[model samples]
Target: GAGVSQTPSNKVTEKGKYVELRCDPISGHTALYWYRQSLGQGPEFLIYFQGTGAADDSGLPNDRFFAVRPEGSVSTLKIQRTERGDSAVYLCASSLSGLLADTQYFGPGTRLTVL
Candidate 1:
């Protein structure tokens, strides 16, 4: 089975621009999540979708960040007015179960470099 994957493994963008990162989850997985990891820090949860609806989106830093999982499979993280502080690795994960205890398989990530 195909595991989760992300695009643009590396992205360089100017400050105040917009960017979009994509994620493809594993087959048959119903739970998907997005997280961001800054240098020397653990991944911080951003948003999660169980099926087509966002189950938890509390971790999204501000209005500039948003995500969507329309078909309950692939998801995209869109950032508007990107800033230098937004430079980080955006990771995506999926799990067989939607519960917190379920193990999430992670994607390589899209490393955004906002200059």
Candidate 2:
């Protein structure tokens, strides 16, 4: 009934721990996106999935970060060996379609604090 939503609004973990952030997009949306936003910086696109496949993943810094949308509705972002620099707000967004003019709606985000 609403737009996209993310879970674990705040997460605190040790540097070497693994973390999983979840996102639930609006029903019927064919495009989903994951983004990372540092304090005072704009959200940077990490991975975008059109349907069930990643359309773009160039923004992922390394293999430590990965995302998946198995059934094309709920997606998860996984981080391995988290670091201090890896701390940021993970945002999820969705669009009706991946078309150029399809407006993307973003969720509140999950704040990750790596200690």
Tens digit of per-residue lDDT, candidate 2, span 10-109? 9999999999999999999999999999999999989999999999999999999999999999999999999999999999999999889789999999
lDDT tens per residue, model 1, 1-115? 7789999899999999999999999998999999999999999999999999999999999999999998989999999999999999999999986987999999999999999
Cα lDDT computed for each candidate against the true fold: 0.96, 0.96
Candidate 1 local lDDT, residue 101: 94
Cα RMSD to native, each candidate?
Answer: 0.8, 0.7
Q: Estimate each model's TM-score.
A: 0.97, 0.98
Model 1 TM-score relative to the real fold: 0.97
Residue 82, candidate 2: alpha-carbon lDDT: 96
Model 1 regions more than 4 Å off: none
